[model samples]
Target: MVGPIGNKFAPIGDPGRQAYEDSLQVFEEVIQAACQQVGIEPVRADQIAVAGEITDQVFRHLIEDDVVIADVSGGNPNVMYELGLRHTTGKLTIQIGEFGQLPFDVNTIRTIQFSRSPRGLIDARNQLERALQVGLLEGPDLLAVTRIFREAQEGAADIELSTPDVTVETSDDDAPGLLDTMDDVERRLAAMADNADEIAAAIEIIGAVTESAGSEVQKAAQSGASNSVRLSLVAKYASDIREPVEKLESQSSEFAEHMESINDGVLALLKMIQSSSPEDRPEGWEAFLDQLISMAESSREGMEGLNTFGSAAEGLGSLSRQLRGPGRKINAAVNNMRKAIATIDSWDRAARSIRKPSEV
Candidate 1:
């Protein structure tokens, strides 16, 4: 199955020793049973080619395998790209995903749903076994869901597949045409639009909260509240802001991971495009690379801002711990308030740095 395999994708618990164990269990049990139902031995991308580079092996499997089962949990980019490659071949492909983690691009496609629980796992295995049997005998109905596969099957009969690179060569009479390219571009644009909307909405909400907190602070100061009371109010505001900052930081990290994957994809595309004739290359390819570079730089800047805020918060915490005595408790509280404001401000700056792609 095409999915993440490392510890980083592992579910949390068991002091981290059981990293990826649950995922492995699900895959080994369900996929093996599915293969048995189809009366075939299961062969994964990793197992087929033991000596070559991992990606090359994966590409070979994507093209040569009679049927592919993709586990698309976490929306892992490598898996998605491989799934795309498999779809382009017009081969039998089945997609499975955790209940809620499937990406938007693949959400409309029919996928066998799985979960982490024991009952869910049992159901998933049974469902996959049936799906596999049907797919092996009659092929799957996923063609309509993936425009790429449908276009390839209709417009490009007999796709060429080679080792180390799964390239599609078409004849003059029945070239896959621009529809497939346009569809890919549309999906990329949609994914970006969704991410931008989410980031914009999150930043707007955070900004509104910060503004309200500032107003309250100002009002409290003018009302002659005691320093202790004002400190307490600020502390509460700081605590509230921390949750969103943490969330934004998590989003930023995920964004960085996704962009790294995009960078790899862009590099691969550039190599492939350069290998082809100038006429075959997509228009404005360099411009596309430039846009990616600009976004990468902005992402780097945002990550740096998060690191800075983290350092500052750690320093403030250290300072607060160093302070002793009842008199210094208010001082510690003030420092915490300052640290929270700094963190919120840092997040706002980070948000600004991660501006819309159109802005770049």
Candidate 2:
């Protein structure tokens, strides 16, 4: 536990003394009680028995704790600083605050909010227990800042897969850092779903044109200049599908990102539903679970199609020199798409893991 230790609980006057006492009550009754219920030992930095620099102790606690319960009440600068540092580790972090007092910057992230009343404290305890249970089951909640590092790691994996047996040489060390915001990345991913249809259509156009043109080119190669005019006419169609090639190039990365987005959303929803009290859950949650599982299964078909199309493009490129350039471009787009889809297979397992609190 980390928060509101120095200035916050310091006895400045009668009012401040009462506030400090009340803070102690909340810690004992709400936070520590929840930890005991979850069978976990709760530790606070100020209560540490070991002698060391306070900063080192706090940092060790924040980094090494199996779980960190952070109280953001009164927006204590020290607490906020510690919380920021904790977030960097992407460890199990549970944020709680006096009701309505969560820092504005982090208000949207999942937090256990509680009133100062006795009843509110009880509710907070129950909620925290459930959160810890669900967190242990699902691992840490994926924060956007921490998520960027994972995404970069996945990008490195993409580079390796794109080059087949060869070691891919790319500087992911310089890859753009934490996205502008999750909302922007999510919005771009949403656009990716729409682009998938367009890309599919473009793939068809390119595939159909290549196959028909390849037959002529094959005959021309066999019989010599007799089929030159036919080759010229058929070859022009590749240029006609230039727009499609460009679309695939532009949108394949976005297309793959949608899969990752879905993976994140699906897991988040699963955790939310699993952690929530029965009264708080939406109707038809079971149906939603089924749908999420189905979505994961459905994604595989698209992945298979794109992969097959990529291989087909490679094959067609060999059939005619005219198609070699465009085939390579489309194949590269396939690499981008595969990169996004590659890491999202976790959603399949996540989908299967969905179960009620009783089952857990």
TM per model?
Answer: 0.40, 0.44
The Cα error of candidate 2 at residue 257, in Å, is: 7.7
lDDT of 2 by residue, 1-360 (tens): 987764354556766566556567768998899889878888877788898898999899998887899888778788888988888788999888887676754543456778888798987787788778768877875666566666765673332122323322447776432232334434544465466667777677767866776676677777665565755755785676677787877777667656655554444454555556667765666655555455444445555556545545544454468777777787678666555543444444454565544542
- After superposition, the stretches of candidate 2 with alpha carbons farther than 4 Å from their true spots are 7-19, 149-360
lDDT of 1 by residue, 53-94 (tens): 888877888888887888887777888988888877777887
Q: State how far residue 158 of model 2 sits from its true place (Å).
A: 17
lDDT of 1: 0.55
Clashing pairs in 2: none
- Each model's lDDT: 0.55, 0.66
Give me the overall lDDT of model 2: 0.66
Superposed model 1: Cα runs more than 4 Å off? 8-19, 142-360
> Cα deviation of 1 in candidate 1 (Å)?
2.1
